[model samples]
Target: EKHLVLLRDGRTLIGFLRSIDQFANLVLHQTVERIHVGKKYGDIPRGIFVVRGENVVLLGEIDLEKESDTPLQQVSIEEILEEQRVEQQAKQESEKLKVQALKERGLSVPRADTLDEY
Candidate 1:
């Protein structure tokens, strides 16, 4: 059966569920990160996944019937990748400004990754 899994790292993977161990480690085939930006969306193929149970935050099945009715425009993987990169750069710049402002006021802000691990 096909499944949509959300990981703790803020990534969503969609694929066929081949198996799951007693610990809930999942085996998925034909996996992909279905990304959306604005009104556009794209899928980046990720062959397979043997996800450790601890990393999974949520797991659910996608209804193929409702999937076909999404209003988002489907775009090429390359286009979506480029857009994602640009968005990240913009966010990094914004974060830098915020950190700098805090520093000027004698306050400290932790690195983005450090804040995300919890």
Candidate 2:
């Protein structure tokens, strides 16, 4: 059976009803978030309290959606080779920029003295 708890603040939490006492108190876990309480019930108190099943709005069983199990397309070898080539070109350009920046700072490397050798 579903469990329900009424906060003195007029909010209700719905879950698998666990247990209740003669004092109209309740204990429940796996609770859903709060629902509005009617002003007719007066202001809810600050402490936890049990709500009667008859008083509950009875939002039916929760439904969770399942994920699709479709497989992703396999990458081709040509695509992988092209990606590697692009990465290597980027690295070479970055090294060239670094050498140019060092030269501007008066920190020349002898090995990088000739653009043709680079």
Candidate 3:
């Protein structure tokens, strides 16, 4: 069965469902992560996976018809990865400024997860 899996850390995997246990642990065959950035996306081949249940945020059957209707443009993996890196860097710079401004005003700002942790 074709399946789409979302990871807690914001990654998406599309593959064939191979097996699952009572705990929701899964084995996926011919897996690849579909990464979306803005109106574009790319697929990074990942092969087989034994996904731990805790890491899965969502799982659903892929609707072939609906999937084909998506408006997002597909790009080469290399290009998309580069775009993602640039986007992340920009976010980090913005966050740094926000954190610094908060500190200057004697405001304590809670730190979010690391910029690259996901």
Question: Candidate 1 residues 80-118, lDDT tens each?
Answer: 888888888999999899999999999998776678655
RMSD of each: 2.2, 24.3, 3.4
Winner by lDDT between candidate 3 and candidate 1: 3
Error of 2 at 7 (Å): 66
The better-scoring model by TM-score among 1 and 3 is 3
> What TM-score do all the candidates reach, one by one?
0.87, 0.31, 0.91
Which candidate wins on TM-score? 3
lDDT of 2 by residue, 1-118 (tens): 5544555544556566566566544555555543222211111222433465455444343332321232433244455445546667998999899989999999977664455843
Compared with the true structure, the alpha-carbon lDDT of candidate 1 equals 0.90
Q: At residue 52, what lDDT does model 3 achieve?
A: 98
lDDT of each: 0.90, 0.51, 0.93
Better of 2 and 3 by TM-score: 3
Query: After TM-score superposition, what is the CA distance of residue 105 in candidate 3 from its true location, in Å?
Result: 0.7
Cα distance off (Å), candidate 2, residue 82: 0.3
